[model samples]
Target: MTKRAGSAGRPTKPLLKAPVRIGSVDARAVVGELRQLHEDAEDPDVERMPADDELFGALLYVEKHAHALRRQTPEVQRAAALRRVQLWEYVREQVDVHQMHAVDDARQAGAQWIELAPVLAVNAPSAAYNKAKRLKAVELTDETPQARPLRRTPEAVLRAERRIASERAAERQAQEVAQLRHELLVPVVERLLEQRESFESDEDIDYWWEEIEAVLPHCQTPLQMVSLRRYLDAVLRALAKIEKRTARPVALSEEALLALAAARKVRQLDASR
Candidate 1:
């Protein structure tokens, strides 16, 4: 009889073995082993099974074992879930202990809650504060006794009233001074405009404006300064129109003329100083 293929010359390859049934095995232990195997497979130095048949066999083994665990009785599943809860609670308690230590150490180092907030990984300083408060991890100090209120004499009260009245009178006097300054400057600006209607060149006009600008800081109020600036802007626009040879002169409002006068007076005051 002819020898079976390859048996006579070379030993035949061994047949693939059936996966072992995982019946009645400790499901948690099996899962833990599977997890370890997965971690080992993920190692860069470890060589994985290259053949498709070998890979498939490994996959089927894990699938059948996992399916068996999933199909276990309801009581077994409940016990597994309870074990997981217990494990998680233990982890949480350890984390709480660590956090409490961290907070206490920070407090001992004289660090404020706001300063410690960023390092605690909380949403905000206030949240960190609340957490520290809940843990009773913050240090406290003794409160000072409250002092009794003092009673003022009638003469003292009268003196305070007089001081307040004086302050009001001073404010009104300052306002009047500012108003008088504004009124005096307006006419000076109008007179300057009447003197210089047109310029020979843009350079001359620019120089003229610069001279006026040098005195602007002498103006008492911001309103006077702002009005002066508006007047200058109008003057520049009018010059631009004149440069274009436009027949119409840029119109000026009564308020703008007053502003021009005020700016000119500010210039004179600045020169005198």
Candidate 2:
């Protein structure tokens, strides 16, 4: 009899394959999730919720993911470089389209390089200004065959544009003031030059007098109106000289004479409002 019955050997189970790890991950999302986990783990109240092991597990998971990302950094950079090149190609295409259109047409269609900069996402709004300058240089070179290449940073281009615009606005304002002065004073000056006996009528002189009066009320400084009145006095004196030289009788109305006298009496023009 033998020996005691041998214990049945435990049934063998088939070996299972390890789970496959992902080769790629979204770095931004992973970092954000890991940051949240770290915050939770460090919270004072977390001890009452998840145990120490759970907190440590979250940290370990993050560390492992970080290591994986570090290993894949070269590949990620390569992909990023490829994407940047593609985006620049798209920008060049847009530049070409802009160049093909007439300047006014491009402006009206919102296809100008400055306008296209935003859609291209080259950088911050203020930092994307160089595309227009660069495109313009390219066009000039193509046309002239030997034009020098232009290379300017976005910031430099922006500053230059602002300076040019301000200068243009100032020039336009000066031209407008010159035109206004011509309209208001030139005809009277011409009449004086021609040695006319008198103004066309009292109403003609009144029209100019009224214009000066209207401008005086809106003058920012007393000196501005004073200067205008001085100029008016000069014109009246010129007229008076012509009349005296021709030995003509006094033709100016009493009101015109009084106005001229008041202008001549102004000794100093004040800058005070």
Candidate 3:
């Protein structure tokens, strides 16, 4: 496929580089900004910044001066109350994220639900599992620091499980695709491009060359790079066929030959799958 005329580059900056103090005056705007961060990242499964350390520190400072805090104006008191609630919301989100991941890790490490139940402050194995699922559901649906309590219903848990599975699969695929590009596709493509003049006279390589050239610049992400795979595969096949059929095959540098060998192994794995 040809490159899109003006595709935007991948965002390099993280959603929240540092802990940000939420404004009590405009909760909705804060939520909107958070939502936009996720959108900007293309909804990748990645860890975000946890609760602000300073927020908790400030809370502790207030506690130490409790009598002085009580002497503050009603409006100031109301703002402090809002800030306290927002801090709790932030901490709650961090707790849910950590707890859900920790439970999964413990299970993967061969720990059972019965063992986890007491530690989770739940009555039974099923309760522990259900609680984790509920937390996962909350994580999947709600944006951070929600004004209202999270509605972690059973229905939401079911949906969250499905989303969790999808996100995991996408994450794995993106990683594998990136590995293939870096270790196999990129080096081989680089060698071929450097030897472009060698294939200029060959009619057989013209189509694949055009394809590779057009697609290379746009391979910025797994989603974009995925489409370039067919073209790469075609180039390998074309080159191999040319070597076999012609008495005078296009000469390859040692680097090109080695890169091609590594790339062929990846191709075999893909074909087997």
Measured over all alpha carbons after superposition, the RMSD of each candidate to the real structure, in angstroms, is 29.8, 26.2, 17.6
- In candidate 3, what residue range of length 10 has the lowest lDDT sum? 44-53
The ten-residue window of minimal lDDT in model 2 covers 13-22
Arrange candidates by TM-score, descending.
3, 2, 1
Best by lDDT: 3
Pairs clashing within candidate 3: none
Ranking by lDDT: 3, 1, 2
Local accuracy of candidate 3 as per-residue lDDT tens digits, 181-228: 455666667666666665413665778878888878767766656656
Between prediction 2 and prediction 3, which has the larger lDDT?
3
lDDT string, candidate 1, 1-273, tens digits: 976785564332221222122223343444454444434435332234222234333334444443344555566545545544443444444455567688879889998878878877777878777665544311111122432111122333344446557878999997776576556655565555554533423554666565455545465566655566455555555465664785543225554445444554575564364
What are the lDDT figures for the candidates, one per model?
Answer: 0.50, 0.44, 0.62
TM-score, cand. 2: 0.29
Which portions of model 3 miss their true places by more than 4 Å? 1-57, 142-151, 163-273
Q: Candidate 1: which pairs clash? A: 185-261, 185-262, 189-260, 189-261
- Where model 1 places Cα greater than 4 Å from the true spot, the runs are 1-151, 198-266, 270-273
